[model samples]
Target: METVSVAIASIGRETLLDTLRSLAAVTRPAGVDLKVLVADDSKSGAATKLVTAHPIKSLDVTCLAVASGNISTARNALLNAADGGWLIFVDDDEWVEPDWLVKLFDCQKEFNADVVIGPVKPVYPDNTPDWLRRANPLYTDWGHRGKRLYTGRGGNTLVRVDFVRALKLRFDEAYGRTGGEDTIFFAQAAERGARIFATDDAIAREHVPQERLSMNFILSRAVRAGQSYGQMRLARHPDPLWHMVFALGALAKCGVAGSLALSFRLFDKARSFRMRQKLSLNMGKLRAVFGRPLAELYKKPD
Candidate 1:
């Protein structure tokens, strides 16, 4: 099996190690090889000792201490370090299933895709709120019938190494902490007519901490979503109306969902769950419309 090198930009050693353990156990398919580059952005150099000690021989691991915080910048560092034909990305806080690499490779072969994106399921440590679970877009791919190209997701996706190299696609550092770097980067790929594909088979699960489930967290996340969308739209057109249109659409979806959730509190069922989900979405939309500071939104209780 020809080796397919994968460079993963990871921060926080402990979190990344969890992901590495999964990768270490992964059974490489026949005629396939795997290597990992951990772009360690932590100043502590935490991943150095951990990754070096792993017992997987086939897995050539390199942990670079990147003294920076941006995920996009870290990823670019990995792209520069890797010498593989295929590149796969996984977030430091997420773990891929043992068959993850194999399945991703299979999808790449099956579609001959330039970029392949798959599902990202959230793995909560303990019992999670229905709203949080319902709010997650994981466990689903929003693809049109016969559509090959898509807005690529950073986690749980694969890309042809040469294709990325040729296009010089890097997550835009301008997107920064609000985190549309992945979306903006993939948008550029899509614009260049890259053959993007999605499959349900390739899966990676991300852990959502309990802290992230609070209403404040939800609202803050929503604000970030607005900022991301605003940037995307502004990049395409100067019109504020388009932004408002998106904001209104979000609000409507949330209103419908919240209405249903509130109505169904008497009976715990799918509708109730959905209602809570929608309400969250609605609040997000309202934030988008008002263009309030994310910090201020977090101050008011939902």
Candidate 2:
């Protein structure tokens, strides 16, 4: 069996501790050599210290100090450092199911996939409103899994080390601070004929911190998502003139969505989320066109 490197890039935050602990306790699949490599992006080297302190015996866990704040750099650091035929990326804030590796590996072999994307469940905080929980305001819809070519979040995904290494794929550092580096990276991979598939059962849980529940956080996340989408579309468009026209259309959508949000925000929970997210996405695309300041969500608030 080939080696599998479970790579996690963290900012050395307190939440990172939980993620590491969970990874340490995960059940290792039989006949597979799996190891955990944590690439730390904190200037303080806090994540490295944390990994050293916990010291999981189930799997070999190692930490490396990488970028100060850039997620792409941190991820790339792990890519270069890890030795694995199969590479699995789990966000530093997520906890994997005990059999996550087994499931992901099984799916990849079953489909002969170059990449396997999995679902990341949300761990809602206590005292959350029932309406918000029902709405699922945090996670995006992955649409029932199939042999689909789609760009997705970094919360949970597996990649063939050969496909990426052969092509020398790296997450764009430019988009690191602003977010969307993962979108661009996977887009490039898909274009290179990488077989990206999804497994619904292989799950990891992402903790939605209290700050992520605020209206401000939701809006910011929506905007970043839109900005990433716009950039992705623009990158793939064949003609520059057509891309410009498409961008204009997206900007117009922002105005329309904003108006609808104002009109219906009082009457509906799901409708409000749908309308507001639409508005935020369009606004983000507009910002991408004019070079607006990015809403850096990963950074600690001042």
Candidate 3:
């Protein structure tokens, strides 16, 4: 029988139980042996302890102690531990629909895809600000169903294990702290002719904590995203001329966004916020081009 491993790299957040609970409730495909692997990156083995304390009776869940504060390292641990024909990745804070796994499998088979990505809907708290809710910057639109994508994210994604192993692909440890390892990994997979497809049916809902609702978090995340894009571009093209051209393009875009933000500052708050976000993203790209170090957003607290 074919094996499918649902992999999660977590730091023992309280919501992890909810994630496991949701997985336990999912409909397993016939003839597929489903397994859940959690790579715990905590020094105290918090996730392992939690799982031991609250075991889900229906699922065969195993928690691996990675003890690495780096998200990439944790994810790599999951990849190393997954012994299966296919692997599914989900965030520790996200809960999936009952048919999420089935839908992912169907999409992969339908498109003959090496990788399948699904959307992550945000669940905002009741106390969330109206403007922040209106903007909804956290929602990820992975294009229409069956649309081919050049790159994919780790969260709510399905991967053919053989393809990844054949390519000897592993999440880069260099991006462990600053995040975006998935972006780099998926971009490399695409470059190597991996077909990635999007599916809307495999839905996962991520709870947006109160801390993430601030403009500070939003702008910082945008910058990090831009930095990831810049890093990917540079890695793909090592030529100095290409780097220079890319930096110039980013600068031009940044200037345009900044100006638009200023123009809309008084009349359109939402548009201004969006333009500012764009400006910050381009600035991050420029920073990456210039080899400036970014803040380690994923660094574990001491």
The candidate that achieves the highest lDDT relative to the unseen native structure: 3
lDDT of 1 by residue, 28-113 (tens): 88877788778766556655656766545545777787757666777888778777677788777778888887777777777678
Candidate number of the best TM-score: 3
Better of 1 and 2 by lDDT: 2
Q: How many backbone clashes does candidate 3 have?
A: 0
- Tens digits of lDDT, candidate 3, 1-302: 98999999988898999999999999888888889999999889988988999988989999998888998898888888999989999999999999998899899989999999999999999987676676677886888889999888999999998999999999988888887889999999999989999999899999889899788998999999899889888988999999999999999999999999999888877778888889989988998998887678785822
What is the C-alpha local distance difference test score of candidate 3? 0.90
lDDT of each: 0.67, 0.80, 0.90
**Residue 267 in candidate 1, Cα distance off native in Å:** 2.9
Model 2, span 1-302: residue lDDT tens:
66888898887667777776677676777777888888878787878887777666676878887756888888899889879788889988888887887788788888788888988888889977877787677876564555576675566889889899999999988877778989888888988888888788788888888888887888888899887877787767758697788778987897888788788778877677778888888878877666566666567311
The TM-scores, one per candidate, come to 0.81, 0.91, 0.95
Per-residue error at 118 for model 3, in Å? Answer: 0.4
- Give per-residue lDDT, candidate 1, residue 197: 85
Which is better, 1 or 3, measured by lDDT? 3
Better of 1 and 2 by TM-score: 2
